[model samples]
Target: MDQVPGSPQEPQDARGDDGLPGCYRHPDRPTGIRCTRCDRPICPECMVSASVGFQCPDCVRGGSGTGHAPRASVPRTIAGGTIAANPRLITMILMGINIAVFIAMTLDDGRLLGDLVMLGRTPPGYLPEGVAEGQWYRLVTAMFLHQQFAHIAFNMLSLWWLGPPLEAALGRLRFIALYLLAGLGGSALSYLLAAPSQPSLGASGAIFGLLGATAVLLRRLNYDMKPVLILLGLNLAFTFLWPHIAWQAHVGGLIVGAAVAFGMVHAPRDRRTLVQAATCAVALLAIAAVVWVRTLQLVG
Candidate 1:
């Protein structure tokens, strides 16, 4: 048989009486090809094409040596399917829920504005009522309700801007947890500080939380933070200066968001899930403690 100059020459033992050699990896299979580097018989499935000829799996693995890096695994989820690890699915779902709730409120009141406002004076034991009266769900529901077009518009705009990137970074579940906890933090603070007759509603708390988280993530990545810091300062100024803005929620969310983001970014890779869970638990407990103290004050 005519042999190519650069091609590997088959070994004399490559063929047995049957004119085929058993595969080095799988003795049951017969093969006509031998590895160029190791000169071992290899089946087609175990063959890796090389410049001169096919190489066996062992030879290919050996050639790569200790420098061979394993391919990264894509995670389908990180937090029990509460959030997806990739894309902005959770952000869109949140935006949709908020919009739907706003529409329902508008229909009920037949007004473009002031339809779903949660007031402090809202009768105790009623839905959307004050936390002092055991209407604890208000802490979560209020985050979804908005008073007017401009109100929902601004909050949704901010959500759209900040949510996607953060969601991508933290995965869906973690981002959702952060958002809810931050909003709860805001509501807890507002419940504690605002007068019994004072009314508050909106997703500003969650938005502010996202802002704070973004700032923390940027700082951790060593990116320039001047732009984010300036934006945060302006929003905080507006929170304090604007009338009926629920600055308490803004402040509360900001603080909680920053704390959560810090824990998430600094968590060790091996113990990430446990650490994240603990961090979330601590945040929830802190908010609950505030609520407990406030409840006692109100009852007294």
Candidate 2:
């Protein structure tokens, strides 16, 4: 009669065909090593068995020996709090250029080049001779100009403080684009809103734009923006409260910066490259339109 399985005395074969002498799970098997946890037959290869059980390689990795679960991989993000990036190089170069220009203008005797470099726009009643003749360069040239040590100091300090992370995030070319466009926006707005009698100078307008851009970009990165907002608010308030300041350029630069950042960061389709290009185009048009209106008013 065939004995039922799990009988107290299952027939023990003294010699197995494999020649290990018994089932691998059997105590008598020369290599028998049942998994302590599962009590399953485990050869040397399958046996990690001990207090845990004969743990297979899969069990050791996926099961609960160490209880250290597997981790999901996260995409890399920008490294903040470090100035060792590409933007710092650009900032240093810009600072050097501005300082060089300042020194040259200071040494030029009558502040002649300095005044022109500073984009001290011609007075309303009197345009600089030949101003209408391709002096459009002044609009751009003015961005690099500064009237005094304090002016450049403040602007450069702001640049130093804000430029690194922004440049890292946006790249050197894009950072420069934002600065130039923001500068143009500021200058154009200043011309548009000026007393026509007043002259303007300094890179403060564009620096303000960079600040705005920084705030926008940080926010997009999911940063806690309470501090940034407070800082921006205080600066805006100061711009309005300070009598000598031209709030117009600051306002213009800020708007342009926000627009640029929005386009560069939040554009829906593509990798934001198209959005950046479109942003530049639109900002240029806006600046042009403002300049056109100002020129008409000036010539009229």
**Against the true structure, whose lDDT is highest?**
1
Instruction: For model 1, name the residue pairs that clash.
Output: 83-172, 83-173
Q: Against the true structure, what is every candidate's RMSD?
A: 16.1, 21.4
Best-matching candidate per TM-score = 1
Summarize candidate 2's per-residue lDDT along 1-300 as a digit string, tens digits. Answer: 122234222444544434533433333434333333334443332233223223433343344334443321221112111222244677777778778877876787735553364232455555462223336666676677766788788888888887765775565677778888998888888878776545566777788888898788767645457878898899899899989887888888889988887676555432446666878899999888888777776666
Q: RMSD of model 1, in Å?
A: 16.1
Report lDDT per candidate.
0.72, 0.62
Count of clashes in candidate 2: 6
lDDT string, candidate 1, 1-300, tens digits: 122123233344444445677666555556666766667776533544443345554455446223333322232122222223235788899999999988888787733333334344454554444666666767787788887899999999999999986885677778889999999888888888888657678888989999999998777645568989999999989889988788888999999998887887666656767888899999999999998898888777
